[model samples]
Target: MKYALKRIFMLVLTMVIVSFLTFLAFELISGDPAEAMLGTEATPERLAALREELGLNRPFLVRYASWLAGFVSGDLGVSLRYRQPVWDLIAPKLEITLCLCLASFVLITAVSIPLAIWSYRWTGTVFEAVRTAFNQLCMAVPPFFTGILMTYLFGIVLRLFVPGDFPDLHTRFGEAMVHLFFAAVCLGIPRTAMTVRMMRSTVISEMQKAYVRTAISRGNDRHAVLTRHVLKNSLTSAITFLGQTMAELIGGSVVVEQVFGIPGLGRLLVYSISTRDYPVVQTVVVILAFWVVLAGTLADLINQQVDPRLRLGGAA
Candidate 1:
């Protein structure tokens, strides 16, 4: 209970800091929301009205306070670009982005873990050399590159799947699967390479520990030694990687979404930024920050369980 409470408090503190920084950063940027709304030829009266309408005429601190209050109450305000409630504009797109992130994560873990375990088992061989080469190549290629390659091959030349945008799963699961699978693969390839490398390193490190040596000395089989002693320890590092990946996924999805024309948060964010929609951008940044902090918190809690030194009581 105490640990959970501490986490919640820290989450709140982190959000407060994020909000303050976002506010300050946007304020420093050129172009006011009112000016963006009224245009350069506007009369002073129209400018004053626009400011009053958007509550921009208020003192900075007061405006921040009011906005924060509304945010806490689930009202993120209206977007100047979309002319709709920020949540209304964001919620539908968020679903798609969240699904994309989740799909990428699942695919990454599924492929990386087995390859990592394989790499650990078959260390120092031609197989290991091949794995190293493959991972290195994947690490070198960016997600956008992979996305484009997939689109060109499977989507364009072969005509195996649609090029961009997700399909309706409700009507046709098959087509939806094709779109999602391509997207997931594009996003997951680089992530899988990075994750596999980290997991393999962690597995190697854990296998060299005294506990693992003890298990091996007890006549335990390789499978038993790995499953019983090493997997959990290795996963701690993987979990941390996944959390950081979560943060990157939200931002990185922009490229993939745009390349494919997917209606996701990444595309929405791109649109908002291009139009200088301050409210939409600010709200999205805050939301992304919350997800990032939450992911970190989850990783910390899991790490505490796997590694006793991370616990508050420092249990062994």
Candidate 2:
């Protein structure tokens, strides 16, 4: 309970810092939201009035405080570009990005674990060598590159889906899922490869520990010992990596969304940044940072539960 509370506190602090830094960085950058919004019609009077209306003319700390307070109260401010409430702009996109990340995570976990175990079981065999090579290849290739290949292979060549023609996520939910699934595959390949390598290595390392030899000496079946003991111990590290992977998937999905022309938060973020829509950009960035921090916090808590040693160490 205490550890969880401490982590929760840290999570809040981290978010505060992230939000402040994001706000500060945007303030430092060269771009006038008012000018961007008014574009060719941005006269001196119009720019001044718009800045005043948007509270952009306020002191940095005051604007930051107002934005932060509004965010805490569920008011995400209005987008300068869209001229709509920021929440309204991002909510649907958030769902799409979440679905994409979730799909990629599911793919990574579903494929990596079995492949890792199989490769471990078949150590030194031809299958293991082939699997190793495949993992290496997957890891070497970036997600965006994989996304392009998948787009060409599945979208263009196979006619599985149209390239850069994403279905309306709201109206064509099923078809949208199918499109996201393919994009997820692109994001998952490299992460899955990484997880397999890590899991296999950890399992191998655990197998060489003293307890494994002791269990086998006591007439425990090697396979049974592996399933009951080694796998559990090996998963601690894998869980940690998966948490980090989850955060990476969020960031990586941006590129994948762009490659596939999906209207997810990542895509929105890119557009928002380009348009100097600070409300949308700030909100999106802070939300992404929150997810990243939350993922790590959850992983840390889970690790402590999985390994008592970590709990004790944390307490100390």
- Number of the predicted model whose TM-score against the real structure is largest: 2
| Model 2 lDDT, residue 270, Cα | 91
lDDT of 1 by residue, 177-287 (tens): 677677778887888889889999999888889998889899999999999889977888898898888777777787887776677888888888999998899989998
Clashes in model 2: which pairs?
none
Candidates in order, TM-scores: namely 0.93, 0.94
lDDT of 2 by residue, 140-226 (tens): 999899888889998889988887788888899888988999999999999999999999999999999999988898889978888
Each candidate: what lDDT?
A: 0.84, 0.90
Clashes of each: 0, 0
In angstroms, give how far residue 49 of model 1 lies from its true place.
1.1
Q: Candidate 1, which segments miss by more than 4 Å at Cα?
A: 158-160, 168-174, 313-316
